[model samples]
Structure formats: C-alpha cells, structure tokens
Target: MAVLSKQVAVPKSGFSPIPVIDMSDPESKHALVKACEDFGFFKVINHGISAELVSVLEHETVEFFSLPKSEKTLVAGYPFGYGNSKIGRNGDVGWVEYLLMNANLDSGSGPLFPSLLKSPGTFRNALEEYTISVRKMTCDVLEMIIDGLGIKPRNTLSKLVSDQNTDSILRLNHYPPCPLINKKTNCGKNVIGFGEHTDPQIISVLRSNNTSGLQINLTDGSWVSVPPDHSSFFFNVGDSLQVRLIS
Candidate 1:
C-alpha cells in the first residue's frame, strides 16, 4: 500500500501520446517492440473490434454486475465465476467484483450470465461475440510479440502460450467507488478499489470504461497512472512474458 510520488503524465487532447499503436498499420510492429521493451505495456488503437459491439459488451457487463448479490451467487464458482476479493482470506479486500471465465475461441464459451438472463436478449450473444473478438486480438498481439522477439510464430513459445486449449482467462472487473475514500484503515492505507498486482497470464488485453484507475510500476520504482480512454485497449505483458523475455 506504499504510494509513489512521481506520476506519469496523461494526455488530455485528441489522442494519448503514451505509446498508442494502431494495429492496422504495418509500422506499428516496431512501436510494439519498443513499448514492450521499455514499459512492458502499451495502448492499442484501430483494433478490429467495432464501437457498437464494445458498447453492447459494456452495457451487458454493467447489467450483469448490477444484479443482486444473492442472484450473482448462483453462477459463482472457484476462480472461474463471480468474485469480489482481490486477496482471498486476507483482512483487506479491494472494492472490486469480477466475473472470470475461459475465453477459448474454439469452445465458443462466454461469461456465465445467470440462467434467469438466458431469454431472448443481446446480453449473452454480445458477450460471446466480444469474447471471440478479444481472443483473436489477444492472439494477434501475441504473435506480434513473438515476431518482435525474432521468434517464429510456429515456435514453441508461441505455440505453447497461444494455443487455443491453453488456460486463457477473460476477467470482467468492476471496481465500485469506495465509500470511505477519505478514511484510512488500521494499516494507514486508503481503501483500495483494486490492489496493485501483476497478472499471471502471458499477457493481458484490458479495455476499461473512462473511469481511470489503472497504474503501472516503472522499473525505477515509480508508479504511473494509465488514464482511461475507452477508445483503446491496454496491453500488459504478464509474469510469464517477463520470465520469457529475461530468460
């Protein structure tokens, strides 16, 4: 819960100047490599997903999370369904709830909406479509990363991590506004919406609503806030990717 003093500057204009890459551009390959090498994260634009679909996905997500806690518990399962704590069994808990599910394109599986919501609506269908789109984009970015590292896409690194059967999880996180924003806990730390932690996957592609709270820890021991711009997706290289890069 230690705070850092230096903050990364966020652009407030036409587009973010913070390593925003257009995936459709061929020149973006070099930028992708540089962003990963320097910060291990970057924002991507011109990703093939449509804005309408994005809106649909976001609306459905908000609806799903807005359900009563008792209703949400129906689809709850370990590490794969609805969850509210960042650190399980720990005294401190983040003000976040998430629905986790496997996002394998071949399986056509989507987020676990309640059975009550299985009627003729766009919620389930939109989620399925969005999951497939995001999965494809994830694979595309992984392939680009492999190419950046001068490794063949068909090589072991790419094949193992990018395999359709691999344990690729899609997490929809909702960080509710903390009620005790001005108050501190016994540990002298403010209530965390989402605790600082690294992801366990090879990489994570995150899209957020314009509520900016994401931060990245720089190598020089400084933390930088990543202001949300709903137009782009944030790509984060995870622990596995770090290990691969270093080794």
Candidate 2:
C-alpha cells in the first residue's frame, strides 16, 4: 500500500554501521559486502556526485516546498497517496513533503510526476542540470554496489534496475514541525524518525532538507539516525535487495 514497505524497528543491534567502501584499494569490495550482509545499510563517501550539485539540489528543493501546497501538489504523489498530502494520513506526516523527478529520459515514464519534474521534453534548463547530475550519481552507485557484491556475468544490478521499473523521481519531502514532535526529537520523531520503511524504489538517493527525522533500523532494536551528511548520498539495501539476500 505504501511506496516504502514497513519494517519492525525494535530489535537489539540498533544502528550498525556498514563498512565504508574505500573503492581506492582491492580490499574495499570485501569490506563493503561484509558490511552490507551484516547491517544492510551504509554511508557512502567518494561517491562521484559533486558537492556543488548537492547544494544546488538542496537549494531547489527548499525553493519548491517553500511554495504553498496548491502549487506543490502539481508535481506528484506517493503510491497510496502519502508523499504530498497532510501527515496523519501517513503516520503523522513526518513533518515533510516531497516531489519525484526521474532522471532517465526514456527509461522512466509518467504522470508519476508533473509538468515541472517531468518536463523532460520541454527542458527547463535548471531542472535539466539537476537531473543530469543526480542521474550520473545514481548510476555510479549502482555500479559500485554491483561490483562490491563480487557477482558477475549475471549483471544482477542491471536486472534489478530494469526489473524495479527503475525510476529516479527526485522526492522533494517536507517535514512540518509539530510542537510535540519538536520536543520529542528536535522536531524529529523522538529518534524514531520516519519509522523504518524500506524503499520500494530500486534506489532512493534521499537528499533531504537540513531538518531532522530519518533513521534506519538495526537488529538490536535501536533506530539510529543517519545524520545528514552534506553533499553526500547515503545508500542502503532496499526491500528487494534484502529479499534477494534472504533466499
């Protein structure tokens, strides 16, 4: 029902860190896989996305949401009508709102997005700039994860992307502050942040606003916030990938 699937968060190993893939040396791959198998999540550095690009995207995001809801809704909505509407409808709203912009020109199709985001044919110049950069970054990470797994000839990554209906709609999420929520976790979810939902998308390069909220579940039952790392995209194994590991 949700674009993101729910996962029980109350476990014991809480917030384990994935091996930061160095990619600089031969040892990086083994470390990367070990981390993924152990925690299923990790923070990435040396990802090709430039700091300037992240800044611009962040800026544009803030600008987009700054508009009133009427203007915002034009972009898009979540699968079960979650992303753009008022919160309580989607677990108290998470104090955030967003839009999805797929980077692929022909790969992802829509009405998944609106005129501004899906303006691929009309090219808004500014949006195009952002699109190109995000797309490049998405592709780069896909390669590393595939390579890191040490699987070959099978091209599992390619299959994953193609199968997921690989869509890169940039989500512009807005988390409004609830007086109670503010106090509970700095306007964050008492550290519970957006619950523990595995992205339905093959890869969600979440580039969120400076505001809080957003944490991952650990086996130990502790939900840890993957603090906002400026200009960096954090990658985690989503539900499909996790299931693939299951069998």
Clashing pairs in 1: none
Each candidate: RMSD: 5.0, 5.6
What are the per-residue Cα lDDT tens digits for candidate 1 across 89-185? 4534688888877766346454356464544268767766887787777767777777777776334454654566877777788877566564445
> Model 1, stretches more than 4 Å misplaced?
1-17, 86-92, 105-112, 118-121, 154-162, 182-189
Query: How many clashes in each candidate?
Result: 0, 22
Model 2: ten consecutive residues of lowest lDDT:
1-10
Instruction: Write down the lDDT of every candidate, Cα atoms only.
Output: 0.70, 0.53
In terms of lDDT, the poorest run of 10 residues in model 1 is: 1-10
Q: Residue 6 in model 2: shift from native, Å?
A: 17
Please write out the lDDT profile of model 2 over residues 1-247, one tens digit for every residue.
Answer: 1222223344354544434665345455666565556666656667565676556555655565566667556644443222543433456434446554455444544333324433333333445666666666555556656677656744566544434455445445555544555564555445332444556555555554455555765554456666676655566666676665454
* lDDT at 118, model 1: 41
